[model samples]
Structures are given as structure tokens and as C-alpha cells.
Target: MNYGPLLFLGVFLTLASSWCGLVLIPQLQLWKSGGLEAVKLEKTGEFYPPMRSGLAEHGREVYRANGCIYCHSQQVRPKGFGGDFLRNWGQRRSVGRDYLRDKPVMLGTMRTGPDLTNISLRQPSASWHMLHLYNPQITSPGSIMPPFRFLFETRKIRRMRSPDALDLKPPFAPPPGYEVVPKPEAQLLVDYLLSLRAVTPLPETE
Candidate 1:
């Protein structure tokens, strides 16, 4: 009795079953669940607000197109790794429940830039985000993040343009002659990015 054929058959069966159990089963569960809700923190604060699914969907497209996942990661590692735990990545360890709504979660594998799970709290200023998006080097002198100038418009205005001229709602549209304008997609992306704040409060030592 040759063992080679038996071994090959056994390995194939194991892989096939594992694939179905791990991949297909979980996908079916998600489909049946009609999307999962994000886990809420025990104590709420002025941190990350509830994410709009519509905005998140649009932002997902932006993330995919801009390849942000290539440089940034969404997952926070457990403490004990050199400076990572010391860094303000998150208040507590990230759990799967935190990303229940993320169909194809953006838990990237690289670390070209720091983790952005808690970026909103870390740098919540809209102006800071605008400048950084327009030109990464302006904020971080040595940053390697590419400038997303295409997402914004640069123009010189002698006088302020009416809110109706830009055809955008107030607040988002700059006052007349603002010099720079964020495209609709850029604004949406910014809104989505700003919404990525980690709402979980830091654990207190009892």
C-alpha cells in the first residue's frame, strides 16, 4: 500500500474543509446579518461619533483608490512591543467587535505611517488635516505620504465667491476668495477620515 496517494488525499480534504469553514462560513454569516453594528464603549465621551454608513462607503472607495492602506494601518498592536504601546494608538486593545461593520476591514499590514485608528483624537484640527492632505510635507517635514493635490483645487480669488457660486452648503464651502477649495470627494474623504477617532477611553489602573 503506497502512502503517497493517501497522504495527498488527506491533505487536500483538510485544506478544502478548512477553506469552507474559515472563508465561506464567515462570509455567509455576514451576508445573513445584513451588516454588523460597531461596538459602543462602556463610557461615552466627546470622542468618535457614530459613523455614517453612507459616508463610510464613499470613504471606502477613496481609501481603495488612494491606496491609503498601503502606507497606513487601522489595527493597534497589543502592549509589550517597544514604543507601540507607549504611542497613542488606542485607549484599549482593539477587538474584532470594533470593526464589525467593516466588510473588508482596512486592517493593513504595513507601517509606512503611524496607525490611524486614533488619529482624530491625536490630531482633530480640520486645518491640520487640510494642510496635511494638500501637502504632507507641510505638516511633517520628513513625511513620505504623497500629496493629494488632485483632491483639492488651488485658485486665486480677488473677491469672495458667493456660497451659491461654489454650490456647496455653508461651513464646508470656504468664504469668498479662500485661495484653496476642497473638492466634494475630498470633503467627504476628510469627513470620513476625521470620524475614525477611537471612542474607547483609556483603562484606569484600579
Candidate 2:
């Protein structure tokens, strides 16, 4: 008795069930739960996961173009899994709806740097972000993250210094009579980084 057909049917059934359980079922559940839509807040009458601004949207492109995703991740692990809550990477566990507005969803796999899920809320200072981008060492001592100095330009100071100029000190600062200022791309990238916030509570994730 040839069991080739029977064996093939069994293997196919097993793979099909695995796919259904792993992928199809979760997708169906998400759709059914209305998890893809923007949630409405009863008090403010505003929606959660607010819409992305034009600058932040452009900044997101800059973030991707600069390959920041390779080192920094945007996902926060749940409790008992990786101690993400203890680390204060996020106020709550990340969920599908948290990424509904993200076009590519930068849930990076590597952890060369800290998770950036709630960076905006954690470090809301734009100047701090500017310095970190210009040179990680200035902000974070002994940081392995490379400086994106090319994003800025050293220009001779005219009548006065530009307000957007990086307030560098000592070796990080440029020579006298000159100041380092972030270009458009650098500002956009910082804007994108400053926009990364996922602290809102969701019914499913909470």
C-alpha cells in the first residue's frame, strides 16, 4: 500500500494549520477587534495615535534614509519577556494599533542602542537630541553610536549666532568665530526622533 499521498496530505494539513494559527488567525482577530482604526477619546473628543505632521512625516523619511533603524528599535517588549517595562522604554506594551500611522513600521530587530518607542516622552528636549545627533559622546558618555556630523555645517558667524546653532562646548564646539548648525535634513531627522511616542494606553495592549 502506497502511503505517499496520505503522508503528503498530512504534512500539508499540518503546515496549513500552523499558518492559520500564526498569521491568519491574528490578522482576523485584529480586524474583528477594530484595532486598525484610530481610537476615539471620550473626554477630549480626539483620536488616539494622532495623525503625523508634515515635518514629522518628512523626518521619518530622513530617519529611514540615515539607517537609524539598524541600531535603534521602536518596539517595547512586554513584562516578563525582556524587562522593557522596568527599563522604562515604554509606558505600556506595544501593539498593532500603535503602528497604524507608521508607513513602514520601524520595529527594528537589533538593540545596539536603546529602544526609541517613547523617546519623545523620555527626552523631550530638542537641544539634547540635536547634540546627540551631532555627537553621541556629548550627550551620552562612552556611547558607541556614531555621530552624524555631516547633517550639520560649520559656518562663520556673522552679526550674531543663529538660534538653531548647536550649543557645543570645548572640543565638540567648532573653532572660534564659527558655529555648527544643523541643516534641513538634520532638523527633519531630529523632528522624526522627537515624534516617536507610544505611551498611549490601548484597550487591547493594556
Candidate 3:
């Protein structure tokens, strides 16, 4: 009595069921719930999760290119699931609809840095983001996040300082006659970072 055929059948069923439960069923449920559709905000009557566009959209490419997703996660853990709520990472847990606009959603795998689902709301200043990108330690002392100095250029000031130049003091500052200005990619990356606001309240997650 060979049990090989029975074993193979059992394994196949197990894998198929796992795939259906993990992927297929969730996708069908998301579609049924209209996760792709933008819902109206109850407060302002405006649309929630607006589409990504312009330089900010392009900046997402830069972020992906730089592997920023490796160190950061965009999804906030639900209450009692983790300390995300206690840490003030987000106002509420992230839902499927919050990421409707992302073409390939960047719900990162690791959390080397803090969650960035609501970075724009937490740190709204563009200059601060620029400085932080150039050197994270400037804004966040003792931070392990690496600086993206390659995305900026240090050049001698002509007659006047570029308005976009990062303001630095002492150790992190360029030479006396030089100023560090962000390149197009850096600006675009900052724009994308600034666009990451997931504070909207949804009925499903509530």
C-alpha cells in the first residue's frame, strides 16, 4: 500500500489553500470593498487618498532607487499589535485604502528607522527634510540613518547664496565660500517624503 500519492495530494492541497487564504482571498475582498476607489472625507467632503502626481510621484522613484524602503516602513501597526500607537507613529492604523494611490505600495519589510506613513504631518518643514537627508545626525542626533550626500552638490557661492542651499553650522557645513544645494533628485525625494500623509480617518480601520 503506497502512501506516496496520498502524501502528494495532501501537500498540494495545503499549498493551494495557503495561497488562496494569503493572496487570492485578500485580493478578492479588497476588490469587493472598493479599496481602489477614493472615498470622500466626512469632514471636508473632499476625496481621500488623492492620486500621486508630478515631482512628488517622480520622487517615489528616487526613494525606491535609493532603497529608502529598506530602512523604513510605511504601515502603522494597529493598537495592541505593536507600540506604533504609543510611539506616536500614526494617528490610526494603516488600512488598505490608504495605499490605493501607490502604484507598487512601499509597505517596507524591515524597520531600521521609524515608520514614515505620516512623515509629512510629523515633519512638515522641507528645509528640515533637506538637512536631514544631507545628514541625518544634524536633525536627529545619534541617528544611524546614512546621509544622502550624493544627492547634493557643494559649490562655491557666486555673489549670492542659493535660496535652496541647506543651512548648516560648523562641522556639517561646507567650506566658507561653498554651499550645499540639493540636486533635482534630492528635491524630488523630499517632495515625495513630504507627500506621505496617511492621517485620514477611515470607517473600516476605525
Off by over 4 Å in 3: 1-12
The TM-score obtained by model 1 is: 0.72
Candidate 3 yields a Cα-based lDDT of: 0.92
List model 3 lDDT by residue over 1-206, tens digit each. Answer: 47999999989999999999999999998888888689998889989888666999999999999999999999999987889989889988999889888867899988999999999989999999999999999999999999999999999999999999999998999989999999999999999999998877788877
Error of 1 at 21 (Å): 6.0
Tell me the tens digit of each residue's lDDT in model 1 across 1-206.
Answer: 57999999998999999899999998787666633434344666432225556875687678778889999998777767645558978766565555765657889988899998878788887667777787777778789998887888756665674231233334444465565677767766776687775445433211
Candidate 2 Cα outliers beyond 4 Å, as residue runs = 1-25
Residue pairs with colliding backbones in model 1 are 160-176, 160-177, 161-176
- lDDT at 69, model 3: 91
TM-score of 2: 0.88
List per-prediction Cα lDDT, in the order shown: 0.69, 0.90, 0.92
- Please write out the lDDT profile of model 2 over residues 1-206, one tens digit for every residue: 47999989999999999999999998898889898789997777789889888898999999888888999999988877887988989878888888989989889999899999999988999999999999999999999999999999999999999999999999888999999999999988878888889877667775
Order of quality (lDDT): 3, 2, 1
TM-score for each predicted model, relative to the true structure: 0.72, 0.88, 0.91
lDDT of model 1 at position 155: 64
Answer with 1 or 3, whichever has the higher TM-score: 3
